[model samples]
Target chain A: MTTFQELRLDGVRRRFGGKDALTGLSLTIRRGEFIALLGPSGCGKSTALNCLAGLLPLTDGSIWQDGSRLDTLPPERRGFGMVFQSYALFPHLSVRKNISFGLQMRRLPRDEVRRRTDEAIKLVRLEEHARKLPGQLSGGQQQRVAIARAVVLEPSLVLMDEPLSNLDAKLRLEMRTEIRRLHQSLGLTTVYVTHDQEEALSLADRLVVLRDGRVEQIGTPEELHNRPANAHVADFMGYRNLLPMKVKAVHGDTVALDGSGLTLEGTPVGPVAPGDDVVAGIRPEDLRAGPHGVPVTVEVVEYQGRELAIEARTAEGVALFLRATERPSPGDRITVTADPSRVLVFP
Target chain B: MTATLPDRDTSSTRVARRHRLAERGIDRQLLLLAPALICVLALFVYPFAYGIGLSFQPAEGGVFGAYRAFFTDAYQRDTIATTLGLALPAAILNVAASVPIAYRMRGRFRGKRVLTTILVVPITLGTVLTAEGLLNYLGPTGWFNRTLMTIGLTDEPVRLTNNYWGVFFSLVITGFPFAFLLILSYLSGIDPTLDRAAATLGAGWWQRFHRITLPLLAPGLATTFCLTFVLAFSVFPSAVLVGDPAGTTRVISIAAYHAAYEVYDYPLGSAIAVIMGLVELAVVAVVLGLRSLLYTGSTGGKG
Candidate 1:
């Protein structure tokens, strides 16, 4: 077993012309940790990775690997492995040669090179197509070859940028499982970047969600999914129901909200002034259909295999979605209830 | 009953007429190729066939007798050897001179367009004017020698005009731009991304050029070689003007011109021209066939 090593970025900033790509972003990656940098497109996730890989010059920052300064090192000298979003495999080389390229660069002994190539090809289960070029392989197979090439060098930290985006749906799921297994087995510090929430939640030990070149939230998947830091994080993590509520009164642990006859419960996660307008968010699954629920008219009913997505509008014209088994069709009046603890209040 | 049976036979005859109409449509399509075929026959094929026939025409004054006599002569044999000697060196020098200059000019800098224009001016002047300029500049009592003598670099004027070097200089000045343009385009056409990739993969500048750039440029180099060689081999005016037509610079094209224009032996001239064309075709074929080894088989499709 190998000991875990740490990677840290100190004030990393990247700028193109006048626009900032990564603005003073800094994070620490633990040894043997699988961290997912999750965000929407153009959220500076890829730019951060490129900066970490030393592919781009940082406008201001320093990168330290196990306490060694790495900001000035060239990409090949940085001692980090990167699998690109497109899996930028050297098209001219065969799968086996691609895996052996770094080793050859190191000028290793011939016998060791052959041994490592075989081991890498076996790890990716690409022995059968070892002699074939990447173009001849399927997208998933090319991804495996890319992973194999990155892993063959056995660098301390591995950075993957949307490696599974090119794969088909079924193959993506399969490779997701494979990647998780490899991460567990290899115990390498990894930073995986993706725009897909499910990909981040399913594969990451901890998630770092970014927005507008800033870190929105950083936590475990459960922490992000359950207690999002803000409305943006909640909306990004699949919280579709956001309603404006006026706080009527605050008493001890409970707060009364306006425009509703019933009192709403929340964790008071953010600062909220009494009688002030605020936003309350709840996951669709947290709301239920019951007799004492809030009155709303159903706009649409969508059956999504295991559950139903009910689009409903309140008497005050507030739109919301509630997940439940029994969904009311369009034009049907329904009442939706939410457990007060499941609701999130933000100012 | 008799009228109904006759109607059925009439319908079958109409079907046969339609089939004939379809056949005529196909005939017109085939006929559309006739004009192109006739042009190729009259313009290209007829001249080539006539040249071969004239080269092989029998004895006395015509046929292969002139070719046989020409080849059998010692002076003609020496001329062919001398032409090859000058042409090959000039071609090689022309290609060599272009590679570095074009390589340097591949990237943009101040005065690049001006330099390229100045370099291309000699090509626009063609071989004859270039040869005249070379004669004026390189003559024994020309500006070059006079300056050197004035500068005390040489006590006597150097013999630069009416020699093999004068013809070679003319060829280089005129042919360099063609080779340079061909190679500059070739070098620029290679995706710069490939260089970046190589660099990211731990390849240094020279290694990237050698391993990636050189292999990709093999086809361009081969083409440049053949084109420059053909141009140099066909040196006629320069060989007659700036060169020693009696001694050193009597090339094969000069031999053909002498046969056709001076001696008024059109058959001999045609035979020599046919030989030159055949030699060029053979060289080009060899060059192309050899380049197959370095070709990575068209980087576009999945190999």
Candidate 2:
């Protein structure tokens, strides 16, 4: 039986043909924790996950599981379950055989293999389709078989690389909950990699946002969404409006943006003094029409059922978007404001 | 029904128009295919029909006379076994040898293209030339044996050419590349992710091969064997040049050749040709029937 309390990645780096795919990635995964490596394409999130699974060799540094070196082991010896973006289920094998693959590989007793495989099938709710080939099953069913195939081995950690990316929107939502439930019920530590921030935010206990092969920030979904480390994270976190502003004054936690017809207040993130240039980030949901605020002309309004997503331009010709219940026509002047906490001022 | 006269008229005209369009399309396609169809009829079908007819109308006792006489005579009947003994081993060895080499070379590596190109050079140089080249290099007292004796690996020159072993070696040299190419194409069709998935599931290289790669490739291997067998079964030029045609390596094709060309016994030769085809067909059918027992799963290239 394999068990581990924690897995440590000490400055793990992967180089591909002289180009660094992952650079100095350091992370500690505690037992039963679901960590997400979230990034756009080519940001090394997949590389980090592959490194953990021992799929890709590390060009620099090492991975340790409970004080023993794990990097030296082959992928088969690592004893980690990895669900590829493609699922990678064997096309030739039946669902039951695919699930029992690891057990058979370990040379386990036949009855024990059958018992574990059946239990895994039950866990994934695929008992009816266990005899079917992967090609014979639906896409959602195939995804479940892939999950069942990996989790049947009872690996200490499960790595999922965009497992739901191929599914339709409804199926994706359903599998998201299913994956979380499995992780919790099985007590399996998970490291999920996805470019979708919403998936990472909802599924992971903590999100590690990577950029250009480096870890940009690592925090909980709420923390990263509300309090981003920089402009890049802020943009990714759905703070759609990032207006360049000059800091007129810094009073306590809030800094006032210079020359708004009505003075706009935003909380400062990095160090700032008088007359310093900074970006003011405002989430579309946070910016609301108030009695007194920055005056702008409504340019385009997209009716989104309950709320109207209004696109407006400020007096200085800077474009901004905000949601409002009030229906506004084009060329109508409106005032929008955010609370000091909602408005993030980044240097 | 008479009240809906215009609607029925329009529907009937539409059906007629559709039929006319289909007929026109088919006619044009048939016209374009005339040349190739004529070539096949003249070259393949006509000769095949003629041979079957000539084989039956033997200058002998009855309609079954040629077949009966060929089977009754020990010398003529033994040729089938001789042919199978040579062809089966050559085909099996070629395909078996190519499997590991093709599997290993499936992935890209330095000098891979150069090596494959060099290996396939024998195929481009046809069977007779390859046999001639083997006769030069691998014959008794040839440079190969000279080197072996000089190095004291063997005292006497190894007898390779002018025997059954010579023809077998020539067949392998000429036929290996054909089998390798076919096997390589089959191996390439399998998704690489399946291998990775197997590895992650705790399968070592050998386990992964026998269980995963071999099963997926079984159907393709069966096909490669049948094609290679057919080619080797009809061994003619190489058996004469590198093998003892009248002695140990008296293949069926050599007997058929002597009957048809040398002795002017066309009916006997035609009967032998038909028998040769029947034997090949029997082997192929047996192989295909056995191949069905393997897991002939889709390679999932679409996925």
Candidate 3:
């Protein structure tokens, strides 16, 4: 089967006064795919989403959908559903009316509007509160109403901007699964913007990591988690242990590092030359107490329910993190080892 | 002190002390409010009660005689219709006209401050000043008619002053800015994100305004219209300056003035004043009741 590109953003740029919020950002989205724009605040994730939704005009570049121009269209003519961070529910309207708003705008038959509204209300499981105003519902319930309102339109694409950020931790988790389930069942193309890496990692089929108004990396969760393209990507992927080292030697696909009386070898994710300064990254979970690598002394041991995180320092005073199922006491000496394939070297 | 203590006596004394402190606090609060209370009673309440009493005196024939005469006399009764005819349309037109202006001016732009200052000038010009300006501006030889004639829009200078339209135009000019300012505040208070969301949901500009903005502003619009109507209804100086006081524009206020000052009929004047207050109250109640029927409590999210 051949996949068709449903949406294409070509070199989209947005400038605010003298500053560039998004600079030549480009992406292609396929049909029925869930994509996440993940970055910290001011990284231009929301700007990119608004540009696609036609809420903000791009300074340059054209957006095409199915080979036709979309950038020139007005936001209302785009026929895309968007859920804002605040839910943006009409407080004066009942849940049913809110969900049926788009259908009414389309001038659908009254009966059909009613039926579809009922179906959407049931989809979000908000039938009991269908007649209640947004103010009467809880935060989670209001979000469900927003989703129903968006989905009832059966739009070609849905854009969500930090929709789960306002919810509590537990609700965020539940809604993450709920969103994934909705995407699967409806098979709707979606573009979600969020600052939470975990949310992007867990909810998205493919995560696009953005930094400073640029795309850092784009890949599946496991791929990006196991193999980040650079030190910044690795750091964002929960690789807490970063060490500055000098490159001792470069083998065809791998590089050897020497720093702080420690020598190690790892695959070079980026270009590196012998005698070049580089940053080495490793996840704490990948480092274990074994007999093959660096020797260090345990300084602090933190008890996480499923695993223990041991903070240690090497003889050369380099910081390291080791995860073990059993707790280790402070002042205990141990050798921590990491697989060379799991290590990342960036020049 | 080794002596047995009576808990009831001590508790009662403690309670009494707290009661005295609370009384002192309330007394201080009342003392602070005394000046405002005295002013209201002396300036508003006393005058209002005195007028009501005067309206019911025997000089006007009997307790209900003046009211009956007001309703029975053809000329006096016609004033109610004439006043409402002018005031209602003027108030409605002011509110309707201000909606779009206020809506367009809600967002910021280059000349927004200048435009706002210009729009607010009419409000600062009180009714008397506004009436005087209208007489000069809308008279047969004034610039308005001169321009119309020069442009060949009319062969003759239009009869704009000393008529019903003269007073009507004056009311609109003065009442519009007040209405616009009120509607603008209401429009700004609404969350703009709601309209954005509506737009993304496939609502066009008119649909968004009609379905979302208008419904939310209904209460505010109704209130503004009621207040503007009251302002237009109590027309005295403007009616005299721009209207044919002896003929077409003898509104209730002019009638009350004539009865009290010209004819020395204080009871009849007070009766008309009492009637005006009752009519204004009735209109306000009806408008507010209709507003409640249209929309419930505020729709804006937890302020």
Best by TM-score: 2
CAPRI accuracy category, model 1: acceptable
Best by lDDT: 2
Per-residue C-alpha lDDT of model 1 across residues B273-298, encoded as one tens digit per residue? 88778777887789878877665433
Deviation of model 3 at A123, angstroms:
1.2
DockQ of prediction 1: 0.25
On the 0 to 100 scale, the lDDT of residue A177 in model 3 is 97
TM-score of chain B of 2: 0.92
As for DockQ, the candidate ahead, 2 or 3, is 2
Relative to the unseen true structure, what is the C-alpha lDDT of residue A304 in candidate 2, on a scale of 0 to 100? 95
What CAPRI grade goes to candidate 2? Answer: medium
lDDT of each: 0.81, 0.91, 0.88
TM-score of chain A of 3: 0.95
Q: Single out the weakest 10-residue window by summed lDDT for candidate 3 chain B.
A: B294-303
Candidate 3, residues A1-347, lDDT tens digits: the string is 11236789899998988788888778888899899998889999999999988889999898988778999998998988999998989878999999999999989999999999999999999989999988899999999999999889888899999999989999999999999999889888899999988899998988888888888988989888888888888888988888889999988887888896567788888788999999989889988887677788999999998999999998888888879887778998887777878778988
TM-score for candidate 1, please give it. 0.80
Q: Give the chain B TM-score achieved by candidate 1.
A: 0.83
| lDDT measured at residue B295 in model 1 versus the true structure, 0 to 100 | 51
Question: Which of the two, 1 or 3, has more TM-score?
Answer: 3
